[model samples]
Target: MTVTPPPSRSAGRVATAVERASSALGRLRRGRLLHPAGRSFVGETVIWGTPGPPSGVALLDQPGRYRTTVRLSKGTPTPGSWPDVLGLALRLHHDDGRPFDLLVSSSGAAPGLRNLPLPRRRFTGTYSTITCYRAGRRRLWLAVLADPDSVDLGRSLATAVAATRTDTPRLVLAVASAVGPWRLVGQVSLGAQLSAEEDAALAFDPVRNLPPELRVAGPLAWLRDQTYRGSRRARGATAQSGGSTATTV
Candidate 1:
């Protein structure tokens, strides 16, 4: 995959404006810009040995397994009964002491309306991403596979306990590692449920934290960091205020 050049001056200006607006919006909400409240889970990921041919990217070239943590939530400050974006954030701890984080939102449930503001069907099961990234000359994406019914409980504090099941949740990342076929990598299993406080402290900044091999070079890449900065600033401000970083589910 050819690397797209960085954003131009005009695009930079627009990104800056969006970031500022996002920060303002977060302050107004007095919480995270998105997925402010969520249930946490500890799990693990296991990459298949024959995942695919060598991808050139070191992370995906070899098969491996690791521990992971996940946060499941509705993208908006609403109840699960409502139609809204579903969210899944993951943190994978590799054996080499590398921690990779991923954040994904559910797509529209209907065909041709994937871009619509529809909630992801069956919040508890699977999550995939159409967004592609450049790894050297290769392009890739990621996915997290799970049983949507793994925890069918509602989005309430009481129901959050259901996520801490005896079975550990695993992270399944789908990456188009090589030119051949899209393969899954970085599978990690989740363990326990994190307390509200612990969840609040965990942050996923893709641009800042993504591994160098997973180089971001698509047309929309420039906007990723800018868009997230607003939320990061807002979250920081909320924490400093000693306010509830997340709304009570």
Candidate 2:
């Protein structure tokens, strides 16, 4: 039919875009969200496994469709008080709009203090462009930047995503700007993964089981804060900056 030509081409374009997205997602869903090699620098590594994870843990609220790990220096993340022990590697796998599984690794980096509104760099922002899947029971975080300090959080989260991509192979971190909020969703555990006589050059004695200037806290507190508070409270859901709200949950 005369009208069929344009529609066919339009469908082709849509199909191509879908194929690209699918291919990328498939790779994300399959590979190691956090490579073991990248995590050699963390002080204490907590691995949240598939099919029954650690107790008091919400990640099991949903199934870990894909397995991965993230190493982070755990502590209370406030503005100006603490430092990012190491740059983190955060990789998430999406399965049907939920972040089915996630892997994140951390390494310490003194990004230096900034005078931003919230000292967000002192805190880490874990954000993603497209979150296709989430673990059931696990919380979702959406960060909306409205005040002076919040935008710094957005930038920090973006940096975390970028660092994660560089730590692994064939990994891509998607960053996009939407109208309402920027979201960070997942059930990835926090803390660092240790190795035998590790090689990354953080000169801490392993036997002490203590990392210098490093403290531990519950896993994924930031994510939990967003998942429970942000999504439910319209304020959290609609927290924004620059005439828009950016969310991470």
Candidate 3:
């Protein structure tokens, strides 16, 4: 049996701070603290083995296709076409019927910058997990990049919403070691937009919804878990439902 260590005092303090901040922000906004506004889509994820070493997580090491619900949002409520840190929240069902959520934000793809969030005016940029996940004894990072062949939609929320009206948007999923180049793992194709009510009811929690093989550990994970709990509490929302009724195209 493996015993997990308790979080450090400093980690506890940081978690508390993050929780309080997220709660306050959510209350002030009367909804989500971070991605206050967003468009939701029904989609699918197609996964396959990468070229490099396996991530040790069965989901990434094997081939699979899963239904997904995705949300695209601006981190800050930046007005109109202004640049803002973008966010992507993806929810899918594992083979065992558990829901797995992955939250990503606009970030760099290169080493030394992959963990840093960057503002963008278009939806066609890189989005990263911004934190590490433990896959066995190795640390891994995940990213989603816009498919170069896809349309380069404009910055405004309206543009993104409108584009989905006519066509589906696609993003390439990749994974990497602590400092290695990214290896292609899968693809996410977002289809029809979800209704406002459906979008409002959806809450993503990657920290709680992850698989056993891919553990979210350390201070950053603690902070994120607390922050997510606080946000949901302030908004009176619960974890995402495994059986989503949203319509897909």
TM-score winner: 3
Better of 1 and 3 by lDDT: 3
Q: Which tens-of-lDDT digit does each residue in 1-249 have in candidate 3?
A: 122324565755666777788889889888887688888888888887777777898888788888888889988869887899989888876656667799999998897888899998887888989988888798999899888887655687788878777887788888998789989899888888888878877888888787778887566776677778789878888876423554444
**Which window of 10 residues has the lowest lDDT sum in candidate 2?**
239-248
Q: What are the TM-scores, per candidate, against the unseen true structure?
A: 0.75, 0.23, 0.90
lDDT of 3: 0.80
Q: What would the TM-score be for candidate 2 when compared with the true structure?
A: 0.23
The models' CA-based lDDT, in order, is 0.58, 0.26, 0.80
Give the residue spans of candidate 1 off by over 4 A: 1-7, 94-98, 108-118, 147-160, 177-182, 237-249
Question: Ten-residue segment with the worst summed lDDT in candidate 3?
Answer: 1-10
Point out the higher-scoring one by lDDT: 2 or 3: 3
lDDT of 1 by residue, 107-171 (tens): 53223332234464355444544355666676655555554434453444335455455444344
Every candidate's CA RMSD: 5.9, 19.4, 2.7
Best by lDDT: 3
What is the clash tally of candidate 3? Answer: 0
